[model samples]
Target: MSTQAKRATIYFDPDIHKALKIKSLETSRSITDLVNQAVKEALSDDVEDILSFEERKNEPLISYDQMVKKLRKDGRI
Candidate 1:
């Protein structure tokens, strides 16, 4: 978290907005904090996925049809 924050305008569905309000009250946190945390977590997941792809960049690629045939041969599909 940073001491300074940026502001943005976001629109949510009515149900989602209501849910956020309820969660904020129950958790004693502001909607801004909750949304920021969620966004940070999503970005972290993306970073992880990118790192994983880079790590396995040299692995052989398998086509979908090939994969299905292999699975059937192995009695897995």
Candidate 2:
């Protein structure tokens, strides 16, 4: 069963609106559908990143001074 989409109006610059319309026509999807999909993907990726950082939070901490000293010794600074 497909979900029914709601109607909403958003204002965009004329050129952006034209480009979006053209892309929508070429891709055979509505502008709303494209925008919703993009937002969903971005949110999902952020969630993944948050989980990754939480997993690594306790690994280690390096001071800036120590990092610079090491870099200088290694001729990387």
Candidate 3:
């Protein structure tokens, strides 16, 4: 409702739009806020995965069966 807010239109099914509107009213937050928060959470998860992958960049890749066999051989099973 801010005069300085930017307007962008997104398409949704009628039912979905209705649900979002109801949720917005129930939560006392704008649709933009809900969408922005969800998007931010998704992007943050992706960033976490990227960082985790980078940290494990030097880890040796092993298949599931290979791992089981190795564990059995090592008597660690």
- Model 1 ranges off by over 4 Å: none
On TM-score, who's better, 1 or 2?
1
Model 2, global lDDT: 0.90
Q: Mind giving the per-residue lDDT tens digits that candidate 1 earns over 1-77?
A: 55888779999999999999999999999999999999989999999999999999999999999999999999998
Which candidate, 1 or 2, would have the higher lDDT against the true structure?
Answer: 1
Candidate 2 lDDT over 1-77, as tens digits, reads 16877778888899988999999999999888888888789999999999999999998888999899999999997
Task: Mark the regions of model 2 whose C-alpha exceeds 4 Å error after superposition.
Answer: 1-9, 74-77
The residue-by-residue lDDT of candidate 3 on 43-66, one tens digit each, is 999999999999999999999999
TM-score for candidate 2, residues paired by index: 0.71
User: How does each model score on TM-score?
Assistant: 0.87, 0.71, 0.72
Error of 2 at 66 (Å): 2.4
lDDT of 1 at 53: 100
Worst 10 residues of 2 by lDDT: 1-10
What are the root-mean-square deviations of the candidates from the true structure over C-alphas?
1.4, 2.5, 3.2
Q: Predict model 3's lDDT versus the native.
A: 0.91
lDDT on C-alpha atoms for all candidate structures: 0.96, 0.90, 0.91
